[model samples]
Target chain A: MAQSNFDRRRINGPEESFQPTFEDDDDRETRWKPGNPRIGRGARDIRPIFLTAGLINQANGSAYIETEKTKIACAVYGPRQSKSTTYNEKGRLNVEVKFSPFSCTRRRVPIRDAEDRSVAVQIQQALVPAVRLELLPKSTIDIFITIIENDGIEGCIAAGSVAASAALADAGIEMLGLVASCSAAVVGKEIWLDPTEEEGKASSGTLILAGMPALGTITSVWQSGSMTPADGIKCMEACQERYTDIHAVIAQSLLDNAQNNT
Target chain B: MAAVLLSKSERAYIQSSLKATPPLRADGRGLLDFRTVLLETGVAPLANGSARLNIGKMAREGGGGTEIVAAAKLEVEDVESGDGVDGGRVACSVTCSPAAYPHLSSNALDELQHDLSVILQQTIGHPSLHPRNLTIIPRKKSWLLNLDAVVLADAGNVVDALFMAARAALWDAKVPRTRAVQYRAPEALKSAKNDVPGAMDVDEGTSGFDTRDMARTAADFELPDYWDEGETLDGREKWPVCVTLNLLTPRHFLDATPAEEASVPQRLHLMFSFVPSAPPTLQAMRLLGPEELDLKDLKESIAFGEQYAKELFTALETKLREEDNRRNIKARDRFALMR
Candidate 1:
């Protein structure tokens, strides 16, 4: 019976579905044209953050972060017994990112796609440097990220990284410092911080940078699309400034959560 | 990378030596140097294009390097009007051979495969080349290029080696030129008597019938024979090649060996596409391993990638040209024997 493929408990959608196309159906109004200025903000400005911690009582530590249209929920569990009972010198960190079926403009099935895995890998790289894994040897820490609503893929991931670190801190796990993240897109000559999906689609390049502000160290950097080296450097510099602001918000939320707990 | 283990003293020694000014690698090479690579193309005859690349395989040595093979298969299929096929489509998959790691469990291998496949698909499978090259008819039929890569050997830096093999395969690829023909059913065809596929041949050469008059619905592609007529992908020079920078504290190197990789804690994988007489543009980048990214030398690190990509592209192009000449000479000799 175990040989039977697929899970029985979950209802499976069609094996495949294609996006329907119609001639002269270009949604020009919603699409951001290239070489245009930032619609509502300056080239180097980022969206305001709405962050909260300790939202889920069931999770060891949980946090939710929202920036404009993108929303991410992160939960951290363990430093508990690992499934593999082999002797280990350092703890194992498992990071998983999933998209809700209705998170994006198009429906996402329960299946985990390549984008989800790529983000998971990026988040793992960002947080692994800060976590004090050697102290919790032979254990495992699991971080689960869920995208409830999505705008741009890079934006969701940057927000998700911040929420993940907050959740880990809320769980009372010891770490060198909290890792904060920021993302931006280069549209024509302008760099739009926290670009929406439309701007990201039309942008020349995308940069996702995450780091620890206290330690002044970058933990991860992922840049996709195409741009010259000069634009990349400028883009990274802009994201670094925004990373600190985002980290400040997380610190304030943790402060508020701490005061309320007492 | 963990297959080769070194003592603590050895690891530290390698790291410190690499940090020295004009840093030295254990293999008697400069810090930015890559191990010599032996590249061969046209390995898979059944596929449209294929390549096999062996890196760090020194002369008179018995299998002391990483080897990878990549193949691109082409299939023509009907597409809906104004559908996704406008740019044609490229699907990519990468798998690790179990033989490469007999000691590792299947789960670990699967994870590595998934990681490599995702990165490759994001960089190479995305549209960099114009799609009209593969489209035989607008909004009707197009060629689907399915690229598959296998890691035959694993010495170290398999990701870099895999991307190189994929690039070479794509470089050696030949897409059989195709002509579109529309079928006009005979006036008495309501009886559904004749269903000869695609309706005609390319040898007919658009002589008499006006293919432009037929509706798009009845159009189909006729593939060319391999005897003579075919075309290589255009603007392949603009295709990106991956360059990895292995970080060892103050110094970073390109195309690290297994021993060099174990001592290093972080790396930057950069993909770049360059054309003649213009600045090279970045395609994608990812920081791997568990360490802080070195921000001080970020600009210089990218410059290294740009320079390395230009050199590697030149090498790849020269090898492909030689292969083409050899094939042509062989063809001439074969035709001479026809007497």
Candidate 2:
């Protein structure tokens, strides 16, 4: 890792373009599919999602989630005293997300790069409203997420959100409902759900939606690049449709953890 | 840096104290008194010039010192004729350590860096610092001085400490000297200009004497060669140092620490440079923080600043001289060791 002369903390340089030789380079020539655009998978289908809670004993609550190649672990500590406490009726939520150095194809510098900070902010926006913060007045809840592996930027973020929700639940914090996120990449006119790292790079636009299924309310939505309003609504619909399946997996994981505890 | 959280009573006490006839500050200093600063030059071995500055609170105030480290490095780059003035260019960058200012969000850090850089460029970019003929060759090559300041700690009044360190580092900077050669276009070439579509047809390159054209010629036209020992920047006496005043409603305070800065709603930053032979000049002033001020109050603040700036200018001049003398003695001792 590179270090600044004045400070020992690692600082990343400009990112290099991702280019790797693949044996099936000619097979998937374009991002859009005439029939099935996905790489050996259904176009509308998502990769397998796995969730487990209470993996970290040190934290009040912890959870781990893996969505195909994207793996994230989250730890929930403190409803503890806030470091900089002021007069506030509601508890403060502090969210920080970091990626491991070898999480992606390229070796990352061990620092909170710009992208990490951005993703952390997105997560904060999504979780702040979902948590019953008024229940823990004048306190602070600290959530730290670490990505162990990342196959796509959107997929990794979605995985982080799911892990955080499960972690909060495991810690026995009150919440309206579980928050789950789904991401889709817009390639030409086609919408590909859970696009791989390569497919994401080829996308013209991307949409990520996080919502609490029980309350039928969206906590946060992020969209970038080019997408029509109709396309955005369709993407959101697709994301909402997947919430049930994600909820079932998370519930099963918690149940299994309780059974194992005995 | 985490701002000291004053209770409702503490806030009330300070506000009322500021409004009192004697106007005693929370730290018990007069409005004009600045925190004590410890400055040392040549702390960085690799840089052309460097300074480390620390502003310590009074013993009664009871806290750690705020530290700022600054370094100046000189590089050279070529420019084309017809560009502009061939003076040395100054670029500044400021970064704050996350450990020192844990309360500052990343977005706040970015904004602070931008504000400091803009002030540094505006204050140091005066043409007087780099006279028209300073470059070796017009538009060929000129000195590019980069001044970088890092705030290792943020007690209060970070901008002032950064400016003080940068001013000292700039005084210590030395730029490499160069030689220039004047070239006259051939008469036949001048005549041939009509054949070329975009060439200038007017013969009086000397006529009209547009000062802008002269500056362009100074920067882009003639070229300079570097072969001699480096030269120090001229008109050192005219270089400026910034003084910041934190305005809290009815009262104004100078050299505010982080806790003090958080309590105030507005700040006025003034750049004052002194020429020994004349009265000190207020080069520029900028108001920061999110508060509107009445025009009359702003004018009054600037007037008050002018008076204090004169005194500060004298103190800085004395300190600079003392540092220069100590650096010279160190250099002589090193030379004697070589002998």
Candidate 3:
């Protein structure tokens, strides 16, 4: 079946959409042969990030983060009474990631698509280890992320984990440490950290890693594509190196918000 | 996959027993051992290739073993319209039989299906897959292989069974050979048409080919009537298979039962290509559970997963070959009887 499930609640876009074709298509294929510098930046550099917490008025806690062209807003709903009829010992953590219809090159449907659900699962796994669900038994913490703009799938997921974790901290939930995530595209022999959609198109492999920088523990690892063991380790290590920086951004913003409240 | 439930006493017994060196699994298998798997290919007659696998049960009529049926189907379409950004692609979906898993909520079942399908889809996107071989016409037409699986039963480590069945199905899958390909309109490649076993069915002059603009061309291809003469998917043997390692702290084991899974604090699922090398290509890896994995365990799990994947691939290869031989013998016997 070709997309049998559509969101009847909202007016849908066309069933098919195509990426715009360019004039210089023939020569473009040979443009990215290894060892050449990326179009605008060094391979090791990531887009400058802007992050903050506690923005939403109705939600328990909220955070918004922007990285170049990508924008993500996250909100944490509750650790209050769960709606489940059955009894649960350890609290439940639910993560939902949604991309706006116009967020990516192709128009996403109003309903949750596979890309959004996959990212949501990754974010939940990344933050589960850090969230002390047992302390809030019989309750559930729901995390929702809205992507206004998506630069790359891997980048969006890594950023979503960071934003979700920061929002959880802002909600005053007890936790081990913040989960900082980063991703990179393995293009040729080089590793481009926090690759954008354009850079990601030519890469052979992609890796997104989430870790607790303070606790020095890995919370989640989602990697795909083809790569040697050495390259996989290299990509993982590259991601680990940047977590402290990303964590610092989240931690500093949280500190700034706390001081302003006082 | 909803979490299996166990009593505190059972959990404690399993945890304490498994934490020791040379950990004793509930099934009495060694650390690097796999549960017995019984698989039969060509189980689905209409599909290109299919396999039904039963793990944790030796008797065919047994009731408790985890069972799964996997099928790989192929369809040809224009490359630009295909969902794949690079080349031909594999689309995977899984559904858990409610008869087997009555306890799982609808939401849990949806989530489980998505996760299982993602692992299969991403693993097949490995560079070694060589999807370009699916090209019927360069940059124009390619094959899209749709892989679907049904989890009939989940004994314990059902994901392993699912992965094995999928790999075997693709292993036995065949691609229809394009005897002749006519790229756009009236200019049918006359030279390539005479060698085919079937009469050519070409759509005449729907559009004409312009040598100056070959990029926007459409292709018409015909498959031979004899399906057995078809070719296998390119680089089928090098495709990766998943090996899930359950960590009970201090020691890890190959396949964990439902009771054993409930006691385990963490699991590491690694997908490795069955290439014969010191370190096989790591197609994909994911960590599941509530605790952080130690570096030692992560490293050990990779090496362990690689070794295990190779062995498992070997076992599957032999099984497929044996099944082929059996089919050939039966076909020959029928031919002699008819003659």
Clashing pairs in 1: none
Writing each residue's lDDT as its tens digit, candidate 1 over B310-332 gives: 78777877887787776777768
Mind giving the per-residue lDDT tens digits that candidate 3 earns over B24-113?
Answer: 767688877777888998899888888999888845655678899999898787766665433576778888887767888788888788
Cα shift from native, residue A13, model 2 (Å): 23
CAPRI grade of model 2: incorrect
DockQ of each: 0.69, 0.01, 0.65
Candidate 2 regions off by >4 Å? A1-262, B1-9, B57-63, B81-85, B126-134, B179-229, B329-339
- Go through the candidates in order and give each one's C-alpha lDDT: 0.82, 0.72, 0.81
Query: Predictions ranked by lDDT, top down?
Result: 1, 3, 2
User: What lDDT tens digits, residue by residue, belong to model 2 across residues B34-121?
Assistant: 8788888889978877889888844775657788899888766565433233565767787777767676788777755665665566
Chain A vs native chain A, TM-score per candidate: 0.91, 0.88, 0.92
Give the poorly placed runs of model 3, Cα more than 4 Å off. A1-3, A14-31, B78-87, B126-130, B181-219, B276-279, B329-338
Worst 10 residues of 3 chain A by lDDT: A1-10
For residues A1-262, write the lDDT of model 2, one tens digit per residue. Answer: 3334223453545434343555665645653454545566765778898889998999999999988788899999989887774767678888899999789767677765645766776677667767888888878999999999999888887778888988988998888888887888777677888777877777655667677777766666655444444465577678778766787788888888889989
TM-score of chain B, candidates 1 onward in order: 0.84, 0.76, 0.83
Model 2: TM-score for chain B = 0.76
User: Of the pair 2 and 3, which is ahead by TM-score?
Assistant: 3
Error of 2 at B184 (Å): 17
Q: After superposition, how far is residue B338 of candidate 3 from its true place, in Å?
A: 6.5
- For residue A129, model 3's alpha carbon misses the true position, in angstroms, by 0.2
